[model samples]
Target: MLAPFTPGATAFGLAHVLAGALVLVSLMMLYQDRLPALVNVLALHAALLGIAVGWQAWLQRAPELYITAAIAIGFKAVAIPLALHRIIERLDIHREVETVGGISLTMLAGIGLVALSLLVMLRTAAQADALAREDLALALSVILIGMLMMVTRRNAVSQIAGFMMLENGLILAAAGAEGMPLVVEISVAFSILIAFIVIGVFLFRIRERFDTVDSAALDAFRGELQ
Candidate 1:
């Protein structure tokens, strides 16, 4: 038998479900090649994170956490994706995502990461708060998978998607933590803004110079210069 459904227990169950969804999306991102699909997946992950935050807010009876959930839904789930879509349209970089390594290998690594996360969390952090430990383990797995995506993908757009996955994991972890104020939420939003600015600038420069957003081609250019 499982734990009884107390108020916090119910919320914890919802958050656990959200974490599972986040991991699934993270795995999907590893295999997605089309720019539009990548964006959609990122949006889904963000929306799940928002749901987790909202559940936490309701269960914990913290009205302030609701504001964090609102920002997560509004800015990450909607605004960022819309802006990225526009950028893709204007920049004409909605081409196929190129990967340095094969898709099958990337997916296998992602699976390994997920398994490792669950095993490690179950074994080492047994004494920590259950939700906190789960969040930490899930966050690390997502982040590692994102890093693998970034390294194996040779398209700027896909790399950006991978980076967003990492951010989503961090948001999940934050949502699962207790007593985190709205300021932390604002800071996360601000960090995402800064990342977008940097990525946009970098993409523009890459596009302007090479007439392509293929990271492989860009790397070749750097090689010739050296």
Candidate 2:
């Protein structure tokens, strides 16, 4: 009778579904060109991630993790999107996102990344914790897809979206680990700092100098020297 249920089982299942949906959402975010929709979807993904972490905290009875969930809900899901939207309005660079790899190919690469994650996780985890093993595989898939989006997209804002998805994966990894004290706090602070620094330097500068924040233009500038 005691062997039927396991700790973190329900929570793990919930987190897996939520994380999987977010991964698909991130894929959609990658190919999106409409600024408002992109922002909305990213915010939604952040909210889902917060919910997953909060559910995990509740199931594990860990009050410390609740704080991380709250930060995810407040800062990432709400504040960051609002700030980014304001920046987009101020910059007035509302245009369709451009991509180097195109949508179909990017999707193919996403599939490949997912398959690779499954293969790697399954092949290497003989003695690992079950929840951790699943989380690692899912998180790595999301991270790889995010990275692929970053490389394929030519719009600065879309690239930022990709970066946020990568951060989401990192949060999942942190939550899945057994003894990662201060990880959530450090990650939140670091993310905010990175975003602030990049936004301050690049967002306005791109608008001012080139009248757009297209990555291709930036790359073209670099290519001109060679």
Candidate 3:
């Protein structure tokens, strides 16, 4: 789809909006209450991530980022979510998210993380361009939120999903950086995809042994219940 306008401030503003949308998607992923719902939203999140990165690529005329965007769209948006859905179906784990943190507290913590990202990026990337700074800050915020999801969620599948979000954040940051090598970017993307597939296989084994993919249940089997 064509951007509403093509010139200076409008393009910049739209790019900012796209990056901000990515951060919002990350925040939304934090509050997803069910496994299937979370996976579905992840597809959307990946699509948005691709769009945001593709926008950056267009603005900066970076052809390598376009490849990155294609990988995200093809693997992340389509392949991974479909694979995760099958995992959920096969494991019969379409249940509510098991979270320790209360909703209000979790949202507050996410906001604080975003604020922290802003402050940290501003201080550390003082010499970078403002647009890059904004993207990096939002990217960091997404990464932190993903980490929070992994810590708070009880299900191994949820943790995998969180890990994917974290990788998404890293991809966004790498896309924004000017000198990042194309080979390095492809390697990182495929590495993440491989890790995701490995986690899915592990989840299959987790289902057979533990009869559940919930980490608490697994821990209980080992007499390490927490």
Candidate 4:
């Protein structure tokens, strides 16, 4: 009975499992307390997202999406994390993440967010492909968890990590869609590159001016100068 399914079907099943792993890693990001550790987890998330996208390309027989996956892995998974790690080391900023609540509480909220996403997406996409619906659900969880990190943490670097994680989710969602335009995918990939350069420069400037990357402190400094 199991032999009836084609190789593509097996591959698709594996891809779904891998994409689901990305959501799990994103949840783990909410658990990390150290800056370096958080960055490491984010790198893993991005890499997993890249692989999932590549799997989608294979499933759909879309060569263009392979390029998209390469872009995702090259930048988000590798370059961004390396640059951010260097910034943290060179700037000598606080290495511990300052969170609004305990890690356990954050984890609970993330779980709730995942459940909410599942309920919403399943109901909303009843007519859609099961894999696509699953993709959206996991993607939404990643995006929400990223938002949670940004809102709860004080460190600007951590916030940037959150933002990248959010983008990772968006990429996953786009990749899972079969007929997403090639130009749109390329444009999205280009935007990630541009964002990385802009954010990198901004972080260096911020570190120079304030000698710290705390969002709360940066706001205070702006107010004082104003």
Best candidate according to TM-score: 4
For 157-193, candidate 2 gives per-residue lDDT tens digits of 6667777888888887787776668866876685777
Candidate lDDT values, in order = 0.74, 0.75, 0.79, 0.79
**Model 1 agreement with the true structure over 1-226: per-residue lDDT tens digits:** 9866687677677778888888988998887777787888888887887787788777667777777678678877797788677767766788865565688988998999899988887688788788888877887788888888877875656666677777767766666667666546564675567466646755664433242467778778778645
TM-score: model 1 vs. ground truth: 0.81
Worst 10 residues of 3 by lDDT: 202-211
Better of 2 and 4 by TM-score: 4
Q: Is candidate 1 or candidate 3 better by TM-score?
A: 3
How many times do residue backbones clash in model 2? Answer: 0
Clashing pairs in 1: none
The number of clashing residue pairs in each candidate reads 0, 0, 0, 0
What are the runs in model 2 whose C-alpha is more than 4 Å off?
A: 1-8, 201-203, 207-226
Query: Using alpha carbons, what is the TM-score of model 3?
Result: 0.83
TM-score for each of the candidates: 0.81, 0.83, 0.83, 0.85
Q: Which lDDT value does model 2 have at 156?
A: 61
Model 2 residue 183 distance off true place after TM-score fit, in angstroms: 1.7
Model 2 lDDT-worst window of ten: 203-212
